[model samples]
Target: MIFLRYILLPIVPIYYLVTWLRNILYDFGIKKSVSYNFPVICVGNLSVGGTGKTPMIEYLINLLKDDYLVATLSRGYKRKTEGFQLANIDATAESIGDEPYQFYNKFKNDILVAVDANRNNGIKQLQLIDKQPDVILLDDAFQHRKVKAGFNILLTTYNNPYFKDIVLPTGNLREPRSGAKRANIIIVTKCPKDLSEAEKNSILKQVDPETNQHVFFSSISYSNSVISSEATKAVEDLEDFTLVTGIANASPLVHFLGDKGLKFEHLNFKDHHDFSKQDIIELNKRALIVTTEKDFMRLKQYESLKDKLFYLPINVVINDEVRINKLIKDFLKIKL
Candidate 1:
């Protein structure tokens, strides 16, 4: 795969040029962009996937849902549906995509979750709803320049910052590193729990944020137990089992589990992999199965695995939570 990416390096410039030109058009207003009067905060990344975007969106939802009628708009990538679909009792991972469905499942009463590839249309649809949202959170729509969000939160992984990456094919970045300028807040996610201030200073130097941009570091916090439809089992009590993952990166979860001295055979799949009959049959053979919460949204739909299937929940633990929350709240106040 590494060799293949290097072999396709020549195509990288073409991809970069196209994406760069698109951003330039949006920047110069040559192409139209719909701006909202209310707060429209976007949590996205320059990379294709795996920068903890879902957790960041959930964090925003939790932060604002108490005082505001918060709503989330996702592109519903790879979903079977079309146009704007408001999540309701009948919503499934297939209908709204895994992340959005997860949001709906968790915050069904507290907030609204909707999906539309056309973000502008999604916002309009949200406005039409009986209970209009005070704030709309756009999930993974950084490159979707049709809708101009009031505040943009760009996420990059601690291991793979966008500054070190180039455009797609050769690198994971969807656009050039210069695109970071558009971000109001840039978060370095999945950092070590004990990351030193010295190292953070080094990273700050590498990032070189603009005067208006705020940089923060965050780490993933995993639940102490694995949850299934029937029961919740403590991580230490679990025996040998099957570890299944359908995400951009599973190494962090794998490492976390390994550190706990747990034993399991891994069945790693590509991000958002649609399980096949054969795959299900194989998974059914395992005595116990553990997976990520996002994957659980889709996997839980299968009746055959309900008894043994389990998932570990994860949340983003930002180093400066109070400050970040204040910044977001301040933005909302100004917009309102």
Candidate 2:
């Protein structure tokens, strides 16, 4: 894999040039980029796979939902549906993609969730709905340059910082490291809870954050194990079972389980992996198969493994809550 990545390094320049040209067109009004009247908070990452975007979005929703009418808009990555569609009473994981569908189901009564390949059009459609939302949260949309967000929160995994990684085929970065400048706030996600000032300074040096941008660090907080939709069997106790995940990054989950004094066997898969029947059969051999909530959304459809699998839900816990809360309050004050 390392050798194959080197073979693809030559095309990095081409990727940079194409991205530059595209942004320049939008900047110069050669291509259109839309901005909505309501405040749009975008939670996205610079890399291709997980940087904990979903949990961060959920955090924001929990923070602001009580005071404001909030809605979530996603590009619906890898969904079967095309154009804009509101997640209705009958929306499933397949219709709006797993992440958005999960959000819809979790916050069905409180939030309006919609998915569209075109970000601007999706926002437009959402605004047209009866009792339009006061604010919109754009999920996994940092690189979607067509929609100008009010506040952009960019996440970079602690293990794979964008500065350390190269573009596309060479590494996981979807855009160049300089793209960090586009964000108003930079969050180093999946950080160790015990990260120190010295380590923080070192990472800041590597990220080279802008003078105007604020940087924050966050870690994953796992909830107690719950029964899988397919299986009615109680997980009994997370400490007794092995953990299995089909997610982009499993380190955070593994660490969380370890902290809880749980001994688990992790089976990691690529991001958004479509679990097969064979995969289910193999997982059944274990006493209990524990997975992330995101994976559970996709795997629940598999009738074969529903009874054997259980999912662990996680939340984003920023270490410096005082500072984060102040920053958000200031931003909302200015926007409001």
Top-lDDT candidate index: 1
TM-score of 2: 0.90
Provide C-alpha RMSD values for all models, in order: 0.8, 2.6
Top model number, TM-score: 1
Residues 37-145, candidate 2, lDDT per residue (tens digit)?
A: 6689889988887898999989988888888888999987778888998999878787888899889878889999999878888888888888898888999888898
TM values, all candidates: 0.99, 0.90
Q: How many backbone clashes does every candidate have?
A: 0, 4
Quality of model 1 by C-alpha lDDT: 0.95
Q: Which stretches of candidate 2 lie over 4 Å from their true place?
A: 227-236, 239-242, 258-265, 281-287, 302-306
Model 1: weakest 10-residue lDDT segment is 57-66
Q: Write model 1 residue lDDT over 61-180, tens digit each, in one string.
A: 889888999999998988999999999999999999999999999999999999999999999999998989999999999988899999999999999999999998989999999999
Q: What lDDT, from 0 to 1, does candidate 2 have?
A: 0.82
Shift of residue 96 alpha carbon in model 2, Å: 1.0
